[model samples]
Target: MSNLNFTSGQTIPNSVIAPVSADGKVCFYVYGKTHLLADVSGYFPK
Candidate 1:
């Protein structure tokens, strides 16, 4: 998720689809604790 942008019209908390970064390098979208399957390792890996 390099230089990716998110533009949503909904007034969401922004925490649910929290952004996660590894070593502050790769940033990816991650769902809340309820969706553990959305984890980085669960999908993408370095």
Candidate 2:
């Protein structure tokens, strides 16, 4: 359980957070935008 920072820009509506564990975990956060999947996925790696 750590801090994952992803997706942060003026064009972006919100941000995405991805938590990595021993087995590679992924989580999504929709604070403002959820349309930046491609941008977010680039950092999460699937």
Candidate 3:
């Protein structure tokens, strides 16, 4: 995994792949006037 750094007033589209919990939940912590959107492209079986 990699980290993304953004400046103020930056508007770019990015894609990331991360793992979710067993209950299919992901956690995010955002700071200061940010908007987030997520989509699940696919899932893997346990």
Among these predicted structures, which one has the highest lDDT? 3
Candidate 2 positional error at 19, Å: 4.8
lDDT of 1 at 37: 28
Q: List the residue pairs that clash in candidate 2.
A: 13-32, 13-33, 14-32, 14-33
Instruction: Name the regions of candidate 1 deviating beyond 4 angstroms.
Output: 1-24, 34-46
Q: Each candidate: what lDDT? A: 0.37, 0.50, 0.76
Tell me the tens digit of each residue's lDDT in model 1 across 1-46: 3232334543323323344465555344554323212233333344
Q: Can you write out model 2's per-residue Cα lDDT over 1-46, one digit (the tens) per residue?
A: 4233455554534444645677776555455554535354465455
Best by TM-score: 3
Candidates, ranked, TM-score:
3, 2, 1
Inter-residue clash pairs, candidate 1: none
Scanning candidate 3 in windows of ten residues, the lowest lDDT window is: 1-10
**Model 2 — which ten-residue stretch has the worst lDDT?**
1-10
User: Ten residues in a row with the worst lDDT in model 1?
Assistant: 32-41
- The reply for model 2, stretches above 4 Å from the true place, is 1-10, 13-19, 38-46
lDDT of 2 at 35: 59
lDDT of 2 at 40: 45
Error of 3 at 38 (Å): 1.0
Ranking by lDDT: 3, 2, 1
